[model samples]
Target: MTWLFNNPSEFAKEMISGFVSANASMVRQVSGGVVRNTASKPDTVAIVIGGGSGHYPAFAGLVGQGLAHGAAMGNLFASPSAQQICSVAKTVNQGAGVLLAFGNYAGDVLHFGLARERLISEGIPCELIAITDDISSASADEIHKRRGVAGDLVVFKTAAAAAEQGATLAEVLAVAQMANQRTRTIGVAFSGCTLPGADHPLFNVPQGRMEFGMGIHGEPGIRELAIPTADELAAMLVDKLLAELPAGISRAKGARAGAILNGLGSVKYEELFVVWHGVARRLQEHGITLVDSQVGEFVTSFDMAGLSLTLFWCNQQLEALWFAPAYSPAFKVGSVIKAPLLATEDIEAPAEESVAAATPESQAVAGQIVIMIERLAEAVIKNADELGRIDAIAGDGDHGIGMERGARAARDRAQRAFQQGAGAGTVLQHAADAWADQAGGTSGAIWGVILNTLGTAIGNQEKPTANAIAQAFSQASHGVMHFGKAKPGDKTLVDVLLPFSEELTLQIEQGHDLAAAWQLAARKAELCARATAQLVPKIGRARPLAARSLGSPDAGAVSLSLILNAVGETFPAVHPQGDTLCL
Candidate 1:
């Protein structure tokens, strides 16, 4: 659904046409998948780049002054044929020779290898530099065999600079190889990407979850789990990459490394920054210093909501070449400096704190009330469209999608608990797990925690009274505060929850019946939710878009009021003797 192309074949040709038209001055289209540009200087070694079409600014955009002399392109997510590579080599090869710099994929290896042989037969000297930077794509024993990622840029830049300086083909290849060896990359995807003209995505990631170490072509990943906060995600990626580095590189090289926070596509600049901030902080904690950092949509997959992190350990020579001036449609060197200082050992030590843990009481009641909760969760899921429409008034329309996805997951968990003959506590815990796993945004997790907390507070409590309801509400509020970090007046669900809790407590203390207290609480919640229209949001996704949200009640708060009112409507006022009480 994301792609607008008529077909994959047409998409490939259209992109090539646009590329050639725009880069006409810098490059000339050759037969097959190749494009050649004049080198900055005659007699300088030439660099040849090649890759599939999806990863833009890679094999194609890098062709220009002080970069690849030509590029061999391929169809979407498919490698260029050997003939394509050979054609590129023949067109670009001069007396000085050419160096093939490309990522390490099976298709690339097969075709580029064949091209090398063909070039040799034609009496044209050609060398190769295979970049293997994706540390997460393979095991430790296979690290050198992993696929390349954004770090390919470092290899291309370094090799091109060396070639531009008149290095021989072998020298250029060696420089590129060194850069490839020193570089490492790892990526995570919040969702899978659809290929051009494909209705379905290459793979499907469950809503509210992410896959760690996913391939560009939607290959299976290391694991899939609930989407973590930007900080948590950054830490996970940096930790994996750091673990794969030479054991003492940090101490030996003073931990100098360049970082590329690349958006896979559809990931906003703000989200990228949030991830980068965490990455930067984590790198510092590991005594790794960031020399230079770039954040943008350098390489994309047609609106895939994912990101890749690349790190290159640099020595003096490689560092010099990295900073060397170069011009290309996609890349430019603006400033150069010596590597930054790494933090001291004491400062870089890992924090000892743990992520907050769920309580024991919630685990107890989950088993007995599984069916009731499952039904409630199903109702929420069914109303997802309506919820989304309400949220669209002042927020991103994803709220409905997020809530529906989360509720279904929770309902499934409740059903599973019932089937497994689990207790009420287990059911609550399972529901929380399902909600977090299915609903990816901040609100889903908060609501899940709230439900779990409420279940815990009322564990096995039968014939619930006003006091019991107040206690459950209080606990739920705590869970929301603990997870969301929003206080009263923050224009979050807490804005509604706090007022409801206060009213419930007051009514119960005044000896009001259970249903009467709930009705009072529901009224207070509605008033509080409506009042949020006048207050500015101070938390979550709404905070940044607060200007647009002015005069609109907080969507979560409004939903909370509605749900509470629905519950009150279902169970009206009842006296202690269980007789219907008049309004």
Candidate 2:
């Protein structure tokens, strides 16, 4: 039930059927399981691209006009056999010769290289261009030997463009090499992907942590770190790529490099834009002019919660060819724009505001609240795995990890603010900022908005009471729902929150005791959370899985209930005064 496939054979057959059916006009299924695009110009140089199937819009989907002439599709994460590669070469050949290009992976190299020998025996000329652009996967001494990631798109397109322009096979091979040499990519995975039909993931990543430089086929990454803000992650990726650029390019071109921000499947476009903003800022800081840029799911690892960054050091020839119009299922030219010009003053903006007129006592309380949030972060980390599992049942299986990781990061800043003795409002604001910076998803962003709103509502309030808390929650709930676009019955965290807020407001208006009011609200939240089982999800990743969730409560709602229960248990003096709390 955890996996989506009936078996490996079925998974592979379904993929092949869907690929050919969807792309029949562009590609034709040939003998020995090869798919050759019908539009490949006979007199033009031939470019053959292939790899495993799961990284769609990659090895196969990209085979079309101004791209690969043919693609050898393999089973999920498994390279195609030499016979399949040969079949594609024979089908696409038109006396122009073939240039074999693919990611620098062992199995692919073996199969493709063997196919090259077969093509030679049949009197067809062949050459190889292996893409090894992932800078994070290897040291400087080993980078050329590392596997390719998202940068393959750049390589395939650059070479294909040259071929389309009537260049001979050798010329196309040279351009492809130039593309690979100028390219570098780095990726981070928030969660591992499952191969089709497999119950368990091909690999495992602990909740709330990220693996940098993970391979497309579920290979382990070079490093594991606490995920940072979209901006921070973007900066980190860009910085590493910049450091690896050819020595003379930055000095000679002086900021004329190009960048591609690619999603490795399952990442939303909005999130990619946020990350791109960070990348643009970081590159600007280094005097590296982003000559051109692209954003989308170019290459993906079947539902992997990750992204990759590719940078290409471009000269006039490459830049001209890069912008030349071409179309494929995954890549498009002319959509890239020249990097924007930013001023030094904008880059060096002040980080702090003047608060000299504020009272010392208020500042001290603010600092204490910051410290409390940091202390609470440890609990978030401890519950990360359980939370991740909960999310997996009805969502992308990342909420638990995302919240835990983000909380832990925010806690670091909170602790520092507390040590400085900041006021409660100041502390809350700091935590909110840090949370957004550390967690780069919808839930984390929502949590940040809530904290920031709570800080504003609590400012200047002398005695915090149940009413004050209720008001703060109500304001926060409004902000979360507004940003997330979830209504109470949408099988979201709002399922628990909406009822809790309404009941708490009612109890406070009646002058009920704080504990008793909270107890009643908690009971209402529990019932609401359970009620989500009868509702279909209408938002986020859960919508597609909602039918299967007919008897299961939304993960977000369940987590909300757990959080409320935990709060009630941890603060017994504030616990409600009835057996209704047992819900």
Candidate 3:
């Protein structure tokens, strides 16, 4: 369990600050994450890597001369926002191009893919490569669907080394992909990891049993068996990893491979070495030459008493790159001379033009919107635990905290925007950005899309009428479906949103009052949200354990319903065609 936290909300920020301070010689603080302190060769491709917090050394600790040029760190167990990724990529760009590398988790895939698009649009060439190296996560034929685990280190290292050699972005991307395809990892856990300030771990293993093929975010393992001796555990890991060889290598006979015995979190270095002894013996028996063996923590799930083994099947080219001289704050290869640290300078984002002036009537509507947002926040906070519990049934248990953070941030930003004489649309837009920036997850990204679409539909020029609100709801639903790529019945917020928006549009077309239409639509959303309890998750991390969520509603769906109902209660009594906006 975690301790010594000043504030649970500020833990990630404080952790980043302390990490940068401790490694001043290796990295400097950037807007989104940390960048290498040493200057790089101009026009060389910059390799930027990242994921959620709790996995140290795998990310920021690898930002140095011979590793990642920069890292985009996010909140614990959450992917970084697209804006955060963009900020770090821009800061690390060296005039030539940038390459984004990360694990193949859904949230990371969505956010990083979006950031790549944004960067490319801005004329800064960028590419993305998601590492899928955990063999246990999927079948050998479905390697692309595998989750990245300890093997992320090998892929990141290869790409960073290629970039350091001044390879073009395409070359670096090819190297990263090659490494990913050649690497395979398998992990087993003795227990689960507890998040900071949480009462219990996200999931737990039975006493005297070990969980096999577990995730780094405290996700339960695929199977469980009675705990074995250290040597037996090591043999199990080695056997599982070696069972599926890379495409080029049919067998491991007379082949060279790089190996890593990684401690998930709480496992001691001494214990890792004990396991490695058995792993090394097995490799030798199998006629596989161990080129470079690493035994310690590389990628980790916080305080999880578990370990993973990664095998990188190396061809001639991969072997050379794998053994190449490299230097980083965490991992290092052969001799590396100390490089001069670059002077620290604040890199501020370009300032936005001021918000447009709002009519007095629109400004009043904006004030009402702020109150509605506050109510949303209050409802979220009140039901945060239940949301988290529902999510924990089949997903990471951070949904409640993430929603709380986004709701509070949205409310705060809406208040500020309203005070600045902004209209309803402008206020919602600001809140949307703030929610995505602070929440930093798939749900956050979807919320940003919903609010931004609604804001755009209800522009600042006029008071929003029932017809306009219905159109905005329709647009919001379409935007979310397009952005999240989640269809109705995916057991996501989209499930609730689609029916609500459709009913809202129908009600408005039937000449209902604004308040009545909204209330009716909200009821539809509530029913849809409750119906999610009978549906299985078809996306995100929960997909693997879809059956486990059979009786629990999607956390996003529940929160959406709660917020919509709260907003409906705040609607004013007014006619659909009245001069005053009813909601």
Q: Which stretches of candidate 1 lie over 4 Å from their true place?
A: 34-39, 247-253, 334-583
Better of 1 and 3 by TM-score: 3
lDDT (10s digit) by residue, model 3, range 1-583: 8767888778889999999999888888877788888878788999899988888877898888778889998898788877788889998899889999999887787778778988999999999998998877777887777888888889888888788788899998999999999999989888888878878887788899888888787555668999999888888888887778888888998999999999989999999898999999999999998899999989988888999999999988888777777777889898667777786553445366357778887887888889999999999999999998888788877799899988999999899888888998899888887787788788888887888778878878788887888889889998777767789888999999999999988988887777787789999999999999999987778888988899888899999999999988787666446433445
RMSD of each: 21.9, 23.8, 2.4
Model 2, range 1-583, lDDT digits (tens) per residue?
1256666546766777777778665555554343443444558778888876778878777776667777876655555655567767777776789888888764566456656876898899999877888876567796555778788888888888888788988888889888888888888898877765557765677888898877665555678899899999998898777667664464623657788888887788999999999998888888777788888887888888889999988877777777776655556565422222223232222235322222465565555455446545655666777767766665556567567756876777666665565555656666775665445345555656667777767663343566887898899888667656678778888888878888888998898755678778988898888898899877654554567678877766766676565555433343344322111
TM-scores for every candidate against the unseen true structure: 0.56, 0.56, 0.93
Best by lDDT: 3
Candidate that beats the other on lDDT, 1 or 3, i.e. the better one? 3
User: Which is the better candidate, 2 or 3, if ranked by lDDT?
Assistant: 3
lDDT of 1 by residue, 378-401 (tens): 556667777776566555455666
* Residue clash pairs of candidate 3: none
Off by over 4 Å in 3: 346-365, 462-468, 576-583
